[model samples]
Target chain A: MRIKVKFHSLLRLYLGFGEMILELPDRQDITVRELIDELNLRVGKELKNKLLDGDEIKKGTMVLLNGKNILHLKKLDTVVQDGDVVVFFPPGGGG
Target chain B: MKSELSMFQRQIELLGTDCQSKIADTVILVAGIGGLGSVVAESLVRFGVQKIYIVDNGLIDAPDLNRQILYTYKDIGRPKVLVAKERLSSINPSCEIVPMDEKISESFELPNDVDGVADCLDNFADRFTLAELAWNKGIFLVHGGINGFWGQITSIVPNKSPKMKDLFAGVDEERQQVQVIMPTSGIVALLQSLEIVKLICGIEPNLIGKLLLIDLLNYDFDKIEV
Candidate 1:
């Protein structure tokens, strides 16, 4: 099983690469936090400081699973299934 | 040529008289008079949107002059809504510009005649409030925002499954003024204006349920499904 992770807006610009497909062998339930940790290991980029502040998503950061925002779900503890596409971005907030 | 034809000749040539008539008949609400709001209202006026209501409570600052085209150096320190109405009217006298000198608070009410709203607000709290109101009012909203070299545009129809507030939930307002450039704000606002025109003209809008994310630094434009 593979979960596709995508970055957008400022996150994409910061991460350089926009996408990563992580293989989760025989894994049925991986939380968003674990995914982020595995993602950092593969990419060798420390996104913890940038994506989160004290275990909560940074003020403007958005974590979406299959077009549904994580804030609507379970935050960092949201369960992820195989083949789910997770997206991240800090939305542009000015006019 | 007829007066209307000569006035909107170039636009009529491209969008056709049918589209032009729709633009002239629709009433729109521009929710801010800042960077994106200024450009959105200006383009809508040029597109021949005859009736519009502009809302803003901020006074123009020297910094706003960088991207807010509706106000000039001489117009600084004046109320944005008043300045915008005057400037928009100067561009097209046929446009009925109504300036609402107030903020988009929970008490704010969207007039029933407004066919669409341009969500050019700079902050998330008010944006969330306005989006909820527009959704409940069954009005279409063309949302645009800019920060630094990035800008985003999306259209939210009342019938759509996802509203702007839903997609942007939990996003806090910026502590300081957001960084925005002229071209980024202009481009995003113009795209939003185009979406408003498309919605008013009975044309299927491209950004409904999709977000047009733009990066001027790299010149990459991506339309992602929301």
Candidate 2:
């Protein structure tokens, strides 16, 4: 299965890429948590620490699955299917 | 009536007499008279809104002058809501300006007549509180936020869209004081005011259940379905 992930704002600065497509093996269902672990290997620890806290996604970072927030679904445990579009960005809090 | 129409001839032409009348009859609440609120409040008045309720508990300081256009150096120690009320009144005397020098929290109560609420707060907790208040009241909420060259705007129509809290569930509740550019704040606030006007005028709002992400640094504008 393949999924498209897009980064925005500070996440793009941290990862150095606006978007990427990941090809995962089709034998097993992949959750958002496993996907983040895979992303950590490619983006390095500095970016990983900003996004994750002990396997759970860090607060202030929004993870959207196919444009719908994953938090409304199942947090990091939300299932991702083929061709799903995932987006990660930190919403600005300042007025 | 003819004389009054001349004051808003340009906007009346664009929105038509019926829609312009609707705008003139709407009442809006603007939370936080700071960066975004300042501009949103002013735009509402200029657009012929019937009344505006402005809330802010903070006092004007030197740092606020960078993006808070409603304040001047002489207003450094004055309450922001009062300053905004005085300024907005002078801009459009017929529009009623209700100023509240109070902070919005879980215990805050909105007036019964408010048609729409603008969440221009500087923190997520207050934004969440405002959103909940609007949701409970069954009114529209226009939300705006800015950090540096990035900002976002969205409208929440009660019962039709997801709550702001549910959409931003994992966001940190702590206030992160960020450096926001003046133009970015101005742009976001204007967009918020536009949403409010569209809502009151019975036009199809562009951001219901959608988020408009603005990246001024990269000159990119994208809409994401929520």
For model 1 chain A, the run of ten residues with the poorest summed lDDT = A40-49
lDDT of 1 by residue, B61-166 (tens): 9999999999999998899999998999998887899999999989999988988899999888888889889999888888888889888888888777588888
Task: Check candidate 2 and list the clashing pairs.
Answer: none
Candidate 1 lDDT by residue in tens digits, A3-91? 98988777887889777888988787799988888887777778877888888888888888887889899999999998898988778
Cα lDDT tens digits, model 2, B26-84, are 88999988999999998888898979999999999999999898999999999998999
Candidate 2 local Cα displacement, residue B212, angstroms = 1.3
TM-score of each: 0.93, 0.95
DockQ, all models? 0.66, 0.80
Where in model 1 is the C-alpha error above 4 Å?
A25-29
Per-residue lDDT over A46-94 for candidate 2, one digit per residue giving the tens place of the 0 to 100 score = 6678788887788889999987888788888999888888899999999
